[model samples]
Target: MDKTEILNNICYTKLVYDRINKKLKSNYSKTEIETLLFAILKETHEQDFQKIGKNFYVSNVRNNIKITINSNTYRIITVDRLIKTKK
Candidate 1:
């Protein structure tokens, strides 16, 4: 019922983490992982980048950088907005 539980229950969360972890372990930087994760999230949900952003985070601003996944593009800012990415 908590935020953590909801995120865990979502298939995209697990897939996103797995893909992002693999990317991270394979020499990708934090920004690159963020970008990759964003793209994967969009692809997995079969949604546009804008919709994905609105559902996933409190803020809706697009990150300056973009990434491609399954031939679709997405924009991501950070891995953890509630903590590491808080401004």
Candidate 2:
């Protein structure tokens, strides 16, 4: 699958997005945040965080998060959802 297809299969939810968004606001680049968010979704769906290090590019040393906003900004919405209709 292509990168976008791989990313699309990630299946991000609002809860996961909030947790990741807070991390992005702290100290993460766009790439790092995306990797972290993917890792989170993978873990939540699989019930473990074992392969995060191997699968994601973000280093474990910097992932220090405590409080989460529980908002819906972390998840990268699909292209279809992002486009706005012109009146």
Candidate 3:
């Protein structure tokens, strides 16, 4: 699916919540995670959608983050922050 369709259909599942927390290594509540993620994605433009294999990687460059969603299910698989580098 495309970015708009995916975002519009974004869904949450109990198991996925655990995965997100583990991947992010944070203890954000479900509500907080959903709210924060949606806020970031809302600011993403069309160009932010990057499809590789079976998932779409929606990235927010300013936040240095990437959100992975299943192309078929539109369920969030995990959230990740880019590792900072020494400049």
Candidate 4:
């Protein structure tokens, strides 16, 4: 799905919330996550999208975060912090 469509139709399941809570470093409320996602996604560039299997992964390098979303269902799978490591 396109960025706009994904934004407009973004959804979350009960299990998804559980997964998200365990995934993120900080504990964020459901409302907080939704807001954060909307803001980040609204500013997403074309290069942020990555398709793997049936999922769409949108990442923002500046924020050091990545979000996994189901393409067909528009459900947010999880959020991950992009940890940096020195060479």
Question: Which numbered prediction scores highest in TM-score against the true structure?
Answer: 4
lDDT of 4 by residue, 1-87 (tens): 578888889999878766777877567888887898878877889578888899999988877788998988988988898778789
Q: Write the per-residue lDDT of candidate 1 for residues 33-65, one digit (tens) a residue.
A: 555554544333223232242343322224322
lDDT of 2 at 66: 21
Q: Give me the displacement of residue 24 in model 2, in angstroms.
A: 5.6
As a whole number from 0 to 100, the lDDT of residue 22 in candidate 3 is 86
For residues 2-42, write the lDDT of model 3, one tens digit per residue: 66687699888898788878887888888988998888888
Off by over 4 Å in 2: 1-25, 46-87
- Residue clash pairs of candidate 3: none
lDDT of each: 0.37, 0.37, 0.84, 0.84
Stretches off by above 4 angstroms in model 1 are: 1-24, 46-87
Candidate 3 lowest-lDDT run of ten: 1-10
Per-residue CA lDDT of model 2 for 1-87, tens digit only, reads 123343455445445444455534455555665676566444432222222222422122223322121122223432111123379
Of the candidates numbered 1 and 2, which has the greater lDDT value? 2
